[model samples]
Every structure is written in structure tokens, then in C-alpha cells.
Target: PLGYIKSISFICYPFAYGNPNKPKKMSELEKRQIEKGDLSCLINNQQDANILYKRIIKLYHQRDMVYLVKPKTLRYWLKSIALRDANEVFRDLVNSGY
Candidate 1:
């Protein structure tokens, strides 16, 4: 019974166990892309995506009492914040363009 329950939990929350097959090192170019406002570079695997999803949900609940704003809105807000904090060249370009 315990083993069965554990298997079910694993199936439901695989990301909690972390991904063993993910690469241990990222190239310098990848790091630079992430720093330059590429949000997708932040999530290298399913575990990272799950972790980010949970964090977004937690932040949404903490910041609002009513279910007015969608989680996607929070995601864009986070992306904008990250982009603004990126290198001066990227920030200046984004600011001037938008």
C-alpha cells in the first residue's frame, strides 16, 4: 500500500523529485541569452517549469484577494521586471521601442 501511494505521488508530482537527466552546465552563450531577457532560458526542464508555476500561483494569491487578475498577467509582469533589470543595452532598446 505504501509503495502504491508513493508511486501515485511520484506520478502526480514528478517535478518534486527533480530531473536527473538535465544538463549540469549551461554554455556562456546560454547564460548571456538569459541575461538579455530570454525568459524561456530560465526553465531548462520540467522541474524548473513546475517550480516556476508553483511560485507564480503563490505570488498571485499573496498579491490579490479577488481572482481578478490572471496568472498570465503576473507572468508578463515578471518578464517585464526581468527585462528591465537586464543589461543596459537591452533595457535601453526595450524602453525606446516601447
Candidate 2:
């Protein structure tokens, strides 16, 4: 029982408090694409955008402590950030003729 509790806590504690050392899932190419402002790799179409929007929400819900305290507020905050970032990326794509 003690071991089980330890293991569960180990898995859950990171979600309660952000993990600074968490490994990023992004590949090198993806990193490069983001840095270059070419988000085609991340969002190629409306479907991709929709999927990514959901993923972003899920990611924040799982990893952000603020989300645990206030789910609605976190959702709104994340939506605003996503919209701003998406607009910037879309502008870059348009300017680059993509």
C-alpha cells in the first residue's frame, strides 16, 4: 500500500505543480519549423487546426496547475493565447505565400 501510494503520488504530483524538466515531445524539425514561423508542419489545414486546438486544451488541462484550480478560467486563457499565436502564425504563412 505504501509503494502504491508513492507511485501514484510520483505520477500525479507533476500535474499539480508544473515540471520544469519535463521532456518536450516536439521533434527537431518541428522546433525548427516553429522557430522559422512556418507552422505548416503543425497546422496544414482546418482539420489540423481543430485537432491541435483540442490537443492544446488537453495538454494544459493535464499539466497546468492553474487549470486544476479554475478549469473555465484556464480554458479561456488558453484559448486567448492560442488565438493570438494562431493569428501570428497564419499571418506569417500568408506573407510567405503558403
Best by lDDT: 2
Model 1 score (lDDT): 0.28
**Residue ranges of candidate 1 with Cα displaced over 4 Å:** 1-23, 38-98
lDDT of each: 0.28, 0.33
Query: lDDT per residue, candidate 1, 1-98, as tens digits?
Result: 01110111111101111244542343456334334543332222246534543221111111111111122334534667545433433444457562
For candidate 2, write residues 25-84 as lDDT tens digits. Answer: 434563343345433333223455345332221223233221111112344347686576
TM-score to native of every candidate shown: 0.18, 0.24
Cand. 2 TM to true fold? 0.24
- Evaluated at residue 52, the lDDT of candidate 2 is 32
Q: Which stretches of candidate 2 lie over 4 Å from their true place?
A: 1-77
